[model samples]
Each structure stands twice: as C-alpha cells, then as structure tokens.
Target: QTDQPVTFLLKDRAPATLSIAFGASILWLLIGLSSGIVSALRRATWIDKFSQGTALAGASLQIYFVGLVLQFILVDKLGWLSSPGYVSPNDYPMEWAQGMILPWITLGFLLSAIYARLTRAGMIEVMSEDYIRTARAKGLSTRRVNFKHVLRAAITPIITVFGLDLGALLGGAVITEYVFNIPGLGKLATEAVSNVDLPVIVGTVMVAAVFIVIANIVVDLVYMVLDPKVRLA
Candidate 1:
C-alpha cells in the first residue's frame, strides 16, 4: 500500500482551485463591469477606445502567455511579487494574497474581455430603449435613469455570463493551475492524463460537471428574482 488515500489527494487540492477561481472572478467582474459601463457611457471617447482595445488584447492573449509574462514582470524583473506557488491563507494571509495575485490577474484579465464587451453592448442597447427615453422625459434624475432604469435592465445578461464563468473557473482552469503550480483539480486531471490514471480523470470530470450544473441552476434562480416576467411565468 502507498499509505496515501486517493481521497486525500482530492481533498487537499480542491481549495487551491476554489480560492483562485473565486478571487479571479471578483477581480474580473469588478474591472469588467466598471470599464464596460464607463465605455458605454462615454462612447467615442478615449476611455471607450481604450476599453475596447484592452478587451481585444485580453481576449487574444493565451493564458499561459499571460501567466508567464506576469510572472516575469512581477516576480522576476520587478521583484514586486513572490514566486508562483499556492500558499495557504490561514498560515500566511499576506503571502497567500501575494502568491495568488498573478494567477488571479492572468485569468481575470483574459475573462474580463468577454464581460467588458457584453456589458458595454448591453448597457448601450438598454439606454436606447423607449422606456429609457420615457424615464428621462418623466424628469428622473440622470443618475437614477442610468442606474435604476438602464443598469437594472442591462445587467441581466451580465449575471448569466457571470454564473457561467464562475462555474467554469471553479471546475478546472487547467492552464492556470499548471502555470501557478497550484495542485488543483485541473493539475490533477492533467497529471492523470500523463499517467493514464482513468479513475482520477473520471472523478475530476464528474466533480466539474456537477459544479457547472449547480452554477447554472443558481443562475436560473437569480433570473426569477431579477426579472419579474420570469417570476410571473
């Protein structure tokens, strides 16, 4: 006997994936939503152009490439960050943040491209709708019109995408795990492929699938709450 349980391998590694995914998701969403909203609000301006340009770059870049560039700039050259590896938050909270920052940015910057475009498009479309004009005519404050009427309606699609992205991230992020040398499910799965470990592969896939399905269900539930039409029907 190897004196090591398969369950132990899984249990020990899951936190890395969870932590990185969650941290990255938050970082991306905040950047995406704000940039997107600003771009939509300031169309034809430098800010809009910059936002679109960055989005294009982000989407086009490969995760591994981004990860390596970030590691080199932040860790190797600048010495602004520590080495790439998982650090337990409980043991060293500051180091944990420092180690995770690069991985988080690698994924966040990539995914933010999709969100930025989607949110910008959604906001622009919502702003032009008849009801939005009506809200303005009704003497609603610009802030209220933009936030209450425009944003609330435009944010639905963003929510759906957010759920999907978070679910997918939680599942694996294979390149990310490997790049960061974080022993998450994704790394395990890839290692299993090299070793021809069938059971581990299957187990990881099942777990990932379950996470995706649950995330979708949560999205649907959120829809019911956000859209009165959904609740009515």
Candidate 2:
C-alpha cells in the first residue's frame, strides 16, 4: 500500500483550484442573474424567447462538449484566447485571467441556463402576487415596482439555487476542470479514482462537504437579509 496521505497530495494544489472555482462562481452568478432578469423583463417578446431557447440549448450540452466547442471557435478558429492551462494569479495576473476565461464560460453556461429559467419563473410568479398589484395600485413606477418589490421577492429561490450551485462548483467542477486541464480538486479526485487511491478520494469528499456546508450557512444569512420574514432562531 502507498504511504502517501491525501493531505500531502492536496497541500499545494488546493488553494489554486479553490481560487479558480471562486472566481468562476462569481462570474457565473453575474452572467446568470443578468440573463435571467433580462428574460423576465422582456417576457413574451422575441428577446425572452431567444433567451429561453438559448438557455435550453446550453443546458442540453455537456460541459466537456461546451468546453471543446468553445476551444475550437475561440482558440483554434479565432485565436482570441489561449488553450486551457493554469497560471498563478499572484505571479501572472493577466495570464491567469486569460487561462481561466474558457473554463469559467464552460462551467458557467449550464449554470446560467438554470438560473435564467429559475429567475424567469420566480419573477413571473412574484409579479402576479397581490403585493405587486398593490404596488402598481399605489402608482409606483414600473421600474420601481419591478426593481424594488418584484425582484426582491422573486430572488429568494434564485439565491437558494445559486447557493447550491456555487457549493457544487466549489466542490469542484469535475468535467470542466478536466477538460480545461486545471489541476484543481476535481482533477485530483479523478486521478485518485483512476489509481484507486482511497485516501485522496476521501479527502476530496471531505473538503467538498466542508465547502458545501459553508455555502449553505452563507446562503441562509443572505436569505434572512433579503426577506425579513426569515427568522433564524
């Protein structure tokens, strides 16, 4: 039996991978929120249909497939971005950003689709609520009603989904990291599985569980802030 412990293997690699996951999650959240809000606001229009169709299409494809297609178009055809690899942000900030662009997009695309659908559904439901009608009855501007009353109420479920998705991503976007050759926890876990390294696999699972718990805690705090009705006793 091999004597190497899981912690030793993950010692230097964990932070880099975690950083990439963190950055990508933030980018994904922003893109997803924007797409969702736009689609909801433009409901029943061509823009809404287009967003819906595009998100469905994106959701259908696997992450590796998306990653490869993006690589082909952006790197092979257009030569606009570099091929997948990792660079330390501390040492080479620009290169780090460049290297991460495709991975982020690849990981974020499906997530964006999910969030778009959730946001649209949530907004539609919230808009029809009595409070929304009361706001309109009070002569609130369309903008104010939508932004202040509608969005705040509609965003709860979206935030919940975002928390779960973010936790999953932090646990490691396995296919995305693999396709992009990122030496993140996902890749490490993959290697361990292939080699039947039980300790490393267990370690990765434990780490992922920790991240997920932390994400849930953060989400609960945010939920309380967003809706005053949530009482955390």
Candidate 3:
C-alpha cells in the first residue's frame, strides 16, 4: 500500500522523537529558571527592561519567521549547520547540538520573558504582604527577607505557571523543533497531518494529554505541600 512506508516511519521515529522531547524540556527548564532568577534580581533595572523587551519580541515573532530567518542565515549563508532533519546524537552529537542551539535560545528566551514578567509581579506582591513586612521589621537581613519570605511566597504562582508551560512544551517543542528541523514530536505531528496518519496523531494527542494531566496533579500536590494554607483531600 502507498501508506505503508509512512506508517512504518511513524513506528520507528515516534519513540525517538519523544526521547528528544524529554531532553529538550530539561533545556527549557534550565533556560527559564536562570533567566527567571536574573529577572527577579533586577526587577526595576535596565537589565530587566532589556530582557523583558526581548521576551516581548520573542512573543511577537512568528515561529515560521524565526525558522525561516535561521534557515537562511545560519544554514544557508554561514553554513554552520546541515539541512534540517532529525539526527541521532550517537551519529552526530556535535552537528545536532550546533543545529539546535539557536532554536533553543530563541524559544527559551521567548518563554523566559513571559515567566520574568510573572516573577517580577509575584515578587512585588509578596514583598508587600504583612508576613514579609513582619520578617523585615524583626531585623532579618535583606537576603533573609527576600529569599525566605518573599521568594518562597512568590514562587507559588511561578510554580503554577511553570506546570502548565511544562505540560505544553512536553506535548511537543513545536515551533522550536520545526524551525530547527529537529526530528521532534512537532515535526511528526505535522507529517501525520499532511499524510492523515490517524494512529500517529492519536498517539501524539494522548501523549500530550498525559503530560498535561500529570503536570496539573503534580502542581497541586506541590502547592499544598509548600503552602500550609492550601488544604487538600
């Protein structure tokens, strides 16, 4: 049958793509956390403004635009990377990493911008709360007031948002993967759509659903544990 090859490709490639998705998610976490810490520290400074501005720019840029620009400049002109395709680290670690680097930065920075804004807002709110004021009034060091009181309270909301973000990203690193030509879940989903591979599509959807559900549950449990007021059955 004409469709046999496509079916076989899905079977062989889907697992590998899922593996990459896991590793990519970790990269996203690191990027978001590091930038978030920096953003929290420089709340009212020029650095905060610049990083937040970059995030806004990232939000505005279409994935297709980012992909096209990279493909043209990095792949075409500079010749730093091979044509986009799924690569095994075992086969070409250096090449795969080189190809994925910019896309990771692009996606990570974009998402980090959103988180930075949330973190700044949350930190400010927590700092104004009575508990935070009480800690400071009791002669706690600036670091103690910030880290132990303000940051702990502020992180609750960040953790909540992060859970949802992680769920979405785990489903697939869609734009980043597509832009970079990494053989990832997003690319597979795209191929499945064009070819109407129902099983693959269903499988991808199921995987996404599982991640979302699991993440939500984990967030709730974490919130209840971290915040004594958050009671649960």
Candidate 4:
C-alpha cells in the first residue's frame, strides 16, 4: 500500500487539476464578463433578453448532463475525445484537450452565467444611482458615464461575489470532475470517499478549504480597493 502509485497519483492530482481549472475559469470569466458589459450597456433590448436567458439556461444545467451530452457528441458521434482517462501530450494533446474541453465548458459556463447575471444586475443598479445621473447631467458622454462612473463602481460587487464563487467552485468541482473523469482533485476526492482513504481525503479537504479561505481574504482586499468606505483595520 505504501508503494502504491495510487497514493502519489492522489497527491499530485489536486494541484494539476486546480491549475487547469483556474485557468479555464479565468478564461471563461473574462469572456463572460466582457459579454456582460455589452449586455449591461444594452439593457431592456433583445440582446439583454437573449444574454440573460442564455445565462439562465447555463446556470440551470447539471454538470453531469453537460458532460454526458458533450461526450456523446464528441466521443460517440464526432470521434474526438477518448473516454474517461488521461492521454499523454506526446501521444495525444489533441485528444487530451478534446477530453478536457467538455468538462471545462460544463464548469466554466455555469459560473460564467452566474457572473453575467450578477454583473448585469449590478450595472443596472449602479446606473440608476444619483451619482450616475449627475455624471450624465454634467454633460459627460454616454460612454464616459457608463464606463468611467457606472462600470467602475458596478464591477466592484461582481468582483466580491466572483471571488467567493470561484472559491466554492474550486472546492466543489468533485462531481463535475467525476462525471467527466478528469483525474482532478475532485475525482481524487470521490475515490477517497469510496475507499475511506482518511489521509488522502483529509489532505484534499484541507487544501480546498485553505484555497477558499485565501480567496475570501483576497476578496476582502479587493473590496477595500474598490470602495474607500471599506478601510482595512
């Protein structure tokens, strides 16, 4: 048992998966937020409706369902990704990305949609505030008012929520990882649960918990930066 590759595999899985997950999340977040900015600026139109509706649908989807659908389309019909296992880059970087892409979208889309909704909501609220109206009435260009005044303030709340959400997703990615068979920290966690591997499970949980705590701290710092009212003690 001590010499088993399983132990080492379990140990290494968390960091590798976390790195990829964070990267994917960040990419999707940037795309989604940029889209959200466009959506907010065009509120009460078809674009807004479509954007919000898409976000709603993405949020409502189950990770497993998304994974299965992608697997069916990509693996069964399209013949893109191999099933439920890692492939070496030297042999199959294409297949590896194909395999991971679905899970990334499954995880990233869910969070992205939530981010869009939050951003749009925040932007709308901020646009309605007295300072925003004053900015506009001061003969500032629409772009200046929206971007300089509204967006700067509006994005702060979104940042705070995003930090917390990312932390939660980092810890809770187990089911998504398992459904996609990604060999990530979440998969390790699931396996540990089945085998009652106390050390592995404890270690994984501690790592995830620490990540969440650090994320919250970072969010607090961001809050202070965004709003002068939030002074650090």
Best by lDDT: 1
- Which candidate number maximizes TM-score? 1
Lowest lDDT sum, 10 consecutive residues, model 1, at: 1-10
TM-scores, one per candidate: 0.95, 0.94, 0.78, 0.84
lDDT of 3 by residue, 62-179 (tens): 7678777877887799987666655566788876666556665555555666666676678877877888888888899998888777777888877888789777776777766666
Clash tally, candidates in order? 0, 0, 0, 0
TM-score winner, 2 or 3: 2
- What is candidate 2's local distance difference test score? 0.83
* Rank ordering of all candidates by lDDT, starting from the highest: 1, 2, 4, 3
Q: By lDDT, is 2 or 4 better?
A: 2
168: Cα error in model 2, Å: 1.3
lDDT of 2 at 146: 87
Candidate 2 residues lying further than 4 Å off, grouped into runs, are 1-5
Q: Please identify model 3 stretches exceeding 4 Å from their true place.
A: 1-11, 15-28, 31-41, 78-84, 90-92, 231-233
lDDT of 4: 0.75
Question: In terms of lDDT, which candidate is stronger, 1 or 3?
Answer: 1
Give the per-residue lDDT digits (tens) of candidate 1, residues 24-116: 999999989888999999999999999999999998999999999989999999998898778788998888888888898888899999899
- What is the number of residue pairs that collide in model 1? 0
Locate the minimum summed-lDDT window of 10 residues in model 2. 1-10
* Candidates' C-alpha lDDT: 0.88, 0.83, 0.70, 0.75
